[model samples]
Target: MVNFLQRFLVFLNIYSIFADGYSFNNDEHTENIHPFIKIGSKYYFINELLKMNWFESYNYCRSYGGELASVESHEELLALQNYILARKIESRFWFDGNDLAEEGKFVSHTTGRPLIFNKWSQNNPNNVNNEDCLEVNLYNKELLMNDINCNVENIAICKYREPNTHCSGKNSLMNQNEVCILRNLVESFAQVGHRCKSCSQAFMFPTS
Candidate 1:
């Protein structure tokens, strides 16, 4: 009798799902969660929270389907710098400038562009202590660039390889098979009261 009462309560809880009109979708959650900014022809993702060494930061950005941001123009660089400051991010951060491939001729492994638009500070790219990686600093009233040691830990800016801002997400039309499966699952759950909550990665927002 106790088991039967517990089962009846579970069924009531499941029925409440029908009263609330919303479906949980993992893909849709991911698609809407990134703090992506489209600048010119590219999208950039900046993170000031989890500072890492240049190599580690590079891999971190790569894991997110992008690399460090590559500046093609001074305007682009300025826009990014301004965006960073306006949000009150960390003072300095590592970016895409590096000459690991060939010393003195800095190039972005991410963008495949020679450092044609170098924004080096005066007497910069000094290669001091074999500094081959680049980091931009917004210390005091100075906005400058420096060639720093790759192992130095700092904030990171990640560039998105692709940005899809089309008509697709959770609200998009579902395929016939998917719709049928979802309907069947909904029906089964409605009859069973099996509430569930999936664990997800919890982290601070990378940007404002």
Candidate 2:
């Protein structure tokens, strides 16, 4: 009976969250939930500790409601590069660019489109030893892109996709608070066979 009640509460909590027409598709909803830093119009989460291969990095970002960072313009690229330099981080980080579909034709894994902007280092994309993954190197005050082997581990940088603006208007705070309460309720029942892992991940609720 206790288990059934917990499951029912979880369902009700999830239902309440959606009943108001709000969903996790909104990046604003996660602003206070995750450790994303806002830069320009997008939010980014840079993992300086955990290193993963290109494919692993791609999925890691998606698991956090984002995708591997993609450079769509020179200004955006400069902003990101500047951020790295400002932080004095010296690690190569993975981006969404790759030439897996076609050699010498780098495209964004996020959008499946040709990279709109690239600041390649001297003679980059050389495909040296089957290099197909893209990474940004910050060395000697220079930020440049390079293609490397997909299996090479690198820091994962993720950019949150543009969010739905439905919750940007009046009463936004009230709505957000309600969603938070619902998410908490669902998480509270998670250990009771409620299985709110998907919902918790969507909202980035702390697992502990």
Candidate 3:
């Protein structure tokens, strides 16, 4: 069992290294209308020409098999900031963080958890007139986050999670938890020599 698990982990890691530059064949709308730009490990879709309200922005990302970007770390934030600066996009953009569920408790709409990292603008998020959505203020050279009115139109920033394995078709976007579950199931059947055929094919495991 332990050896099987080790092999599974190694296989996923190896596949991920090769999947780094793999171009995903997405929907026609996503391919032509709003293509994602690879930055670091993740892919982001930002439309500077289009502006939408917080709800609209969230739905737009969902429609494209992504979520409103949740800036989880300083490094990720810096990369996004650099991209925006290079493009000279001097406009606010909606991210996944929001306090709409509860006042003063900012959470990521994507993860349903408290924001992991936030560089708030000085003396901001004052909830002035019921501001509930989180947006990055690129107009200000500082590129700080601010809680703003949900109805205010802003550029939509969508992000797809990094691909972890080379699994094709529906299994391609499986999350880590799903992978763990599948791995456990595979390990359970390994000793019996009855491993799942699809799983073996997806991970390139030896069938025999």
Candidate 4:
């Protein structure tokens, strides 16, 4: 396993250098460095600091039209990370790779190795606390496994396996969560009406 990781790392580095050149001198160039790759007809991107927990990773991915990465090898992991770095966006990101389902049996989406690159934050994976998910630090490119709590709000780098044309539509599933709010908005508009009269005559609800 170690030998495999070593070889994979070497190959990944070479690939990184080979595909690292780009020109961002203009807006067109700026938008050219997309941090994503199409593998097996599925699109994957780097987790650019998704400070989300385990379950959040699941839901967040769903909301974004993808699922947490199920990497199965070192090459794939490196490829995904390199794609992100190639963009020169941030230093690190997040991936949907974990094995909380069977604790201590750490697994990698890449290679499916029982013990792959398990670079955790200091005093991490203790599983002693709430942390169960993982995030790749953009600076040192290390992984930090953490727990998810709903109260904490962390911006996540979203990925999609397949691009949906409705992704940009305001009425798309992404915006469905706001359905109630949208209803309230429509209600408010109805109360105000198209041509407003005196407030006294506009809304004369019975005082109960």
Clashes of 1: 0
lDDT tens digits by residue: candidate 1, 1-208: 3343455567657645632333345344435546756654557887766889999989988888888766767887788767777787765788887888888988877756786576778898899999999998875644568999999999888877643333323443332234443555456655543332222212211222
Candidate 4 C-alpha lDDT tens digits along 1-208:
3333455467556644433431123223423334644643345654655556445656776665566564445565565556555666653344555556666565544335564454455665565554444555543653244433223444454455432323233554333323333454445545554334444532443234
The C-alpha stretches of model 4 lying farther than 4 A from their native spots are 1-42, 45-54, 98-103, 106-124, 138-208
Name the best candidate (by lDDT): 2
Query: lDDT per residue, candidate 3, 148-204, as tens digits?
Result: 999999999899754355433345333333444455545555743445433554355
Top-TM-score structure, candidate number = 3
Model 2, 1-208: lDDT tens per residue? Answer: 3445655677896677675655444434666647678775567999888999999999999998889998777778778888898898888999989898889999988778898889999898799999999999975777789999999999999998654434333444445544554555556555643454334442434335
Model 1 spans with C-alpha error above 4 angstroms: 1-33, 39-41, 139-142, 163-208
TM-score computed on alpha carbons, candidate 3:
0.67
Candidate 2 runs further than 4 Å off: 1-33, 164-208
The alpha-carbon lDDT assigned to residue 23 of candidate 2 equals 48
Q: Flag clash pairs in model 3.
A: none
Cα lDDT listed for each candidate: 0.69, 0.78, 0.76, 0.48
Cα shift from native, residue 70, model 4 (Å): 2.8
**Model 3: lowest-lDDT 10 consecutive positions:** 21-30
Q: Give the clashing pairs for model 1.
A: none
Higher-lDDT candidate of 2 and 3? 2
Score candidate 1 by lDDT: 0.69
